[model samples]
Target: MASTPIIATLLKGMAMGAADVVPGVSGGTIAFITGIYERLLAALKSFTPAALLVLKREGWRPFWAYVDATFLCALFGGILLSIATLAHGIEFALAEYPLQVWGFFSGLILASTIYIGRQLHWRALVVLVAFCVGALAAIWLGSVKPVNIPINTLTIFAAGAIAICAMILPGISGSFLLLIMGVYPVIIAAVTEFNLKLLLTFMGGCVVGLLLFSHLLHWFLQRYRQPTLAFLCGVLAGSLSIVWPWKHAVVTVVDRHGETVPLVQRNLMPWDYESITGVSSAWPGVLTLFVVAVVMVFALEYGARRLQLKRAANAA
Candidate 1:
């Protein structure tokens, strides 16, 4: 057969790449969004001995024999291209118009949360406990600041590994992890400005993390599926903290030059632990956006299912 599947994989990867570029979203989520999550997972799991042998001996030429090489190439190609093409636009958009962007994303995630939450097979007691656990933990973690860990190769590698997991898992955003860690803006600016040294170091860390973590997750899925699903549901729940739409910020501190820096912002997400009282919830527009997001995801899933059935029918 012609490598049509390979070409299709690249297209899927491109969609994933766009997802990866955005904060509070993930390429893995995009994989799920685009109806190729299972294939992506299978491909991740396919580092077999024969594959290794081909990679070791015949190199890139023989990789196609072992896996849908076209797909892999296409997907990565799309991801890289997305990073290159979309990153700056996303950055500029967020800078120029933050509240509106955040509002839309918050809505997207809220609907996503509901969609994923309803899929859980938790019983009454389980649902109550899981929601409480998930919500409480999210509230708790939202208040925690990034402990200033020393920057080193090992730490970078570990950070990369851990960060990649968020990107892979639905509802968890790798960018959110980095933001919580106080590195999200730093790294994005680095990439945006094309700082070679910083970019390479970050990539080195991410690669090491991905290789080790993907296998660990695979093992977890195989052996502890129920608990894993529960935990993931919790994670999806917890992530809502990062995207809450509104909060109060004070105009207290001045810059070092005493130029009287006026207005600034702080978050209730962090300040709630300090006995600060503030109400933060989605408003009407945000809620509408959330509903739209749910509809979008459902529509995408429906389309994907129809395509899959058609393809299967043709094969038969």
Candidate 2:
């Protein structure tokens, strides 16, 4: 079977990693937009007990072939490398230019919502209901207050499982889910400090969650693509609240390092933010960035389509 170039897959994975680091933007959206979503899901779904049996019976080469190991390894290596290299830079940007960062992500997700919604041909009431439910659920989840939880092995494992599942779902972010669960800081600390034990535990949970959830999601997409897409669109719609550029932290807590962090925040209008914080609203800059993000998505889509057409012509 023809396969995507390793460099291309690695770049896609890096893009996904960059998205996954943000609160509102989803790696799944990047995977979808980059035309790797189905292929990634299919690769993940290849990991079954039966495949393990083949590993034992047919040896390493056949097992690797069955699992598409080369693609998975290249992609996942890129993801890990991205996280390791970009995490601190992303953290700095979010701290220094929160509004711009949020604006960019909001715009990206808005474009994704439109893109995904356009693919759905369903006009059924049930699909609409699913969309509404997904939106409402995300809105509520976004509003929930973060609770302080002890950083332990079991908690890390559980956080990994939940966060990983969200990470792969369109419009849901693993890092955001971690923030919601109160483990974001701990996980970030682990990554920055090179805490191997904690990292390994979290990764184990991620592997388990990714394998299981990918199968379920793959099946759903295959059987009910329209409704599934509608639901994802709704999720992206609802997540906008979480990424709103202007907000005031209503409740905050001092962390282990004595840095103040928001535990709960309330969305604010641009004018209201200026009124409360006595800072420039920078509305024009935000709007410009948002428009740029939207245009970037469309440009990426156009390029991907052209590439596909070129490939088809060559194959013919």
For this target, which candidate reaches the highest lDDT against the unseen true structure?
Answer: 2
lDDT of 1 at 301: 70
User: What is the per-residue lDDT of model 2 for residues 252-303, given as tens digits with 9 covering 90 to 100?
Assistant: 9887778898888999999999999899878888899999989988898899
**Per-residue lDDT of candidate 1, residues 1-316 (tens digit):** 2233656667777766666666666676667567565455556666667788888888886776566666666777877777777788887866665545566666555655665666666775655565567567655655555443555556655666677777777667777567556566566777779977777777787766665666677776677655555665676666666555554545443333353421333555433623453433425555566567667777877877798788889889
The C-alpha lDDT values of all candidates are: 0.64, 0.87
Deviation from native of the Cα of residue 138 in model 2, angstroms: 1.1
After TM-score superposition, the amount by which residue 247's alpha carbon in candidate 1 deviates from its true location, in angstroms, is 2.7
List candidate 1 segments past 4 Å from native. 1-15, 18-23, 48-50, 54-62, 65-67, 117-119, 124-138, 147-155, 249-288
Quality of model 2 by C-alpha lDDT: 0.87
C-alpha root-mean-square deviation, each candidate = 5.4, 1.5
